[model samples]
Target: MSTPLEANQVEAIQGYDAEKRYKYLVKEVVANREIWILTDEHGCVMLNTDYEDCVPVWPNKEFAESWATGEWEDCKAESISLNKWHSRWTHGLEDDELAVVIFPNQDEDGLVVYPDELDFELKQQARKQNQR
Candidate 1:
């Protein structure tokens, strides 16, 4: 069954173009520190942030918001343009250590990497990972 939208959420999202959609970043926090990568209902990982794409697009606001509420209640969602996503992803990131911290992803081990590294290659890796 499709989850019903909460009144406040519905109100907050009112006036949005139902026909228009944009990409959103959804995050899940673990242990109060580590941020885990979250996938959308389609199983695509939400790695785009305000720093990366110029026009990241989603199918619709409801599809984007589904991760923040409803069945995906544990995730947090943020709408982002493609440009913003890339911009924030690399902004203020210097050391490899800071890179990871600014942008984190799921690690091979259950324990997530905090203050993790975001080398240029990581972005490519994430995009490829999302395809899977």
Candidate 2:
């Protein structure tokens, strides 16, 4: 397992722009071999964007927990193993026509991407990591 992120590291990552944050998500999720999301009693949280319904994902629990405020106060941070994400989530999300919001910050700003796109990138990153 990966070491837990320090407070400063979390703070710094939260301050990053959307692109940088998305990149961080790719790297951290690959290293940790899991993807973080918010879930309440009902099910996984979903955000409605201008164009599509997106499921917000984070690189770690700390980042996911940060979003559990206000309306989402009851939400809990949950992890989906990278293997499960690739094997199940990718196909399920695509079938449901849902996108993914990668590492949203306080302002709820993030990069919306297709499930297949993210799955491909994560797979590529995992391959590169394995090679090193």
Which candidate's TM-score is highest? 2
RMSD of each: 15.4, 0.9
Given candidate 2, what's the lDDT at residue 53?
99
What are the runs in model 1 whose C-alpha is more than 4 Å off? 1-64, 70-77, 92-119, 122-132
Tens digit of lDDT per residue, candidate 1, span 24-109?
A: 11211111111223345564243333333121122234434543555556654443343443465335333322312222212111
- Name the weakest run of 10 consecutive residues (lDDT summed) in model 2: 1-10
Model 2, 14-131: lDDT tens digits are: 8899999998999999999999999999899999988999999999999999999999999999999999999999999999999999999897489999999999999889899999
Clashes of 1: 26
lDDT of each: 0.33, 0.93
